[model samples]
Target: MKKFKKFLIWLVGIILVVLIAGAAYLHFSAYQPSTAANQAVKVAAEDNQETFFKAKQNKLTVIFYPGALVTPNSYAIWAKKVAQAGYTVKIVHFPLNMAFFKVKAADKVVNSNENYVVGGHSLGGAMAARYAHQSDNPHLKGIFFLGAYPDEKGRLDQKKLDVLSITASRDGVLNWSKYRQGKKYLPKTTEYYQIKGGNHGGFGSYGQQKGDRKATISNGRQQTIIAKKLIAWLRKIK
Candidate 1:
């Protein structure tokens, strides 16, 4: 019995060590934002909220969550593009650069008086869906996903929400099985698009992801396509 107790203690210690190491890696290896994109749109930072604003009033506001381990600024280019098209974009910073740590972080940026959409990439998308599914925010009209899916726990299909799910054609890092299973949880009217030649990391301007497939198209092209589609979808919202 003493030997068994010793083994159990050793196993717990090993698990704790592994968890700590993984957390450290995630902290140190987080993506850094690029400075090459010209600041044509109004970029403002407030606490964890990074806003790319246009001059238009009554514009639809989009609150975006970054993928796990990706810095919120990595999505600035896309946000700026959307802003240039006359909509307001806000990229939310998650605690520890992981959305799972703060699933309702979108609440901080949402304006209850304005029309809005909530979305994210990868794990961020899952948490965004979780927030939309659980929250009673009447301003939220839609959900967007980039190489992501709704969390199974929330089952967004039950809610009367519009959804747009965009996936990459050659995404090596996305879990196909879970993505397939997640479709059942989305509404029947969900608009789905697969960007040909795009990869998992193409949604943001961050450097190449470790396990992601190489994108066949340039990041600029991918971002342009995403912005165009998103803008079109927002216009369709009544």
Candidate 2:
């Protein structure tokens, strides 16, 4: 009995030491400054570009929701890209990760705009879909989901599904089985794009985590590519 107790104590001590060391390393690692506070900053587009933002004031509006526990600032760059592509972009922040909380916040920002395209990163994408599906807005353009899955419903409305776009990669946090099951509720024409080399957490709007610079660079490249494609897709529809 005494020997067993000693063994357990040694195991606990080893685990504690490892955890402390890892925490220290991560804290001291290369960390990028967060630009999350600049959520309202819009990116400038090319001259003579036929984007939705320039076409008319009543043009389609695209709203971006950040991932779980993330701020809208993380998706600012991506939102600006879409805005540049001609869609008026708005990034809505939820008080918490709950969609119920986000829905009310987003409602204030929508203001009866008919042509709205709602999208999000990770769990935020799921929240956006839930809002659009449950709302009475017929003018909603479409939904773009990034690294997220449709909720319990095997169905999103046909109108929204017609314009749905699912962008995910192997590294993303999607449960393919659950995602596939939800597809039954979506429009048969919904587009799906698999982002290569992307992770479920890394593709989020938030900036890179404090870690190896190489990993950060790789994730940044993938995210940039995803953002560009999103802008292109939004422009084509606008």
Candidate 3:
């Protein structure tokens, strides 16, 4: 009987060691980037033209939200360009950096508007999708996704109706693997724009910062070029 107890104790100790090791692996793994190893590149200042084509006489309004765990300042430059195009663009400030709650704030900020569009980066994009998915907001024109993916729970269904999905060719952050998931919610009518030298966090104000993470391109000129393209796309629909 004593022998059996000792053997059982030994077995328990072995199981415990394995469990601890597995947990350590998972914890460390989560800290690693989802993409390849590259230096965090700094982006350039915004020098795009101030010309903005007004889509509507009253002026089209857009609610812009940032990505998860990202600050609103990162996309400041992009917002300025969008707003410069004769559209009133509102960049959401998520105190918690959580897109879900941040989107709720956007709805309230945009309490009432005859013509309004919603869009964001990464998780922010998903938040916009959820907002437009609801049938109540008929004025919600559409959404733009920048290196953003839809949640597995069907919140990204808006892409099927009126959505624009843009991805940077060199962006490892939102690589093809991560982008493929968005396809399920994309409609045949949805438009796709591929930014040649863009990265996951390229378009925003972070353009000139090395940032806490690595980026695809650090060239200010290239980022500005793509920013111009993004503005052009917004104007095309205008």
Candidate 4:
């Protein structure tokens, strides 16, 4: 019995060590923002407020969450494009660069008086859906996802929220089986799009992801397509 107890203790210690090592890797190996994304627009940062691209009129607001281990600035190019097209955009930074660390991070930046849409990429998108499912914000007009899907807990189908889900045809990082299963959680009216020749990393200005498939399209082309589709959707909402 003493020997068995010693083995159990050893196993527990090994597991804890592995968990800590993985967390450290995630924290240190986060994706870096591209130079073009950095130069595309001047992001506004305020104390305790989310980093944002502010439009002159602020006709609409979009609060975006970054993917796991992705730096918030990696999304600057996309946000800048959207903001120039006439909507205010804010990218919420997650603790330890993971949206799962704080699923309700968007709550800090959502303005009650402004019409807004909430969305995220990969894990971030899933968390955003979870937040929208539970939030009672009257100004939240839509939910957007980039290579991400809602989990069962979101109850979006029952709530019948306006949702847009965009995925790359060659995305290798996203689990197809899980994505298919999660589709049931979305409302019947959800609009879904598959960007041909695109890959998972094309949604942001971050360099290629470790396990993602090679994108046949240029990053610029992919982002432009995303911007056009998103702008069209925003116009409809407005």
Using TM-score as the measure, the top candidate is 4
List clashing residue pairs in candidate 1.
Answer: none
* Tens digits of lDDT, candidate 1, 130-165: 999888878889999999997577679888788999
Best-matching candidate per lDDT: 4
- The lDDT values for all models are 0.83, 0.58, 0.58, 0.86
Model 4: per-residue Cα lDDT over 122-192, one tens digit each: 99999998899998878788899999998987658877467889999999899989999999999898898
Error of 3 at 121 (Å): 0.7
Regions of model 4 farther than 4 Å from truth:
1-24, 41-43, 46-49
TM-score: model 2 vs. ground truth: 0.67
Clashing pairs in 2: 51-86, 52-86, 53-86, 172-200
Cα RMSD to the true fold for all candidates: 3.9, 9.8, 10.0, 3.6
TM-score to native of every candidate shown: 0.86, 0.67, 0.65, 0.88
Better of 3 and 4 by lDDT: 4
lDDT of 3: 0.58
RMSD of 4: 3.6
lDDT of 2 by residue, 1-238 (tens): 9999999999999999999986566444422224542432434232211111232343577766666655445555555555555667666645443344555445666657456777776667777777777766766667887766667542474654344454445443466677777666667777777766565555544454332122323545665776687766766564
TM-score of 4: 0.88
Steric collisions counted per model: 0, 4, 4, 0
lDDT of 4: 0.86
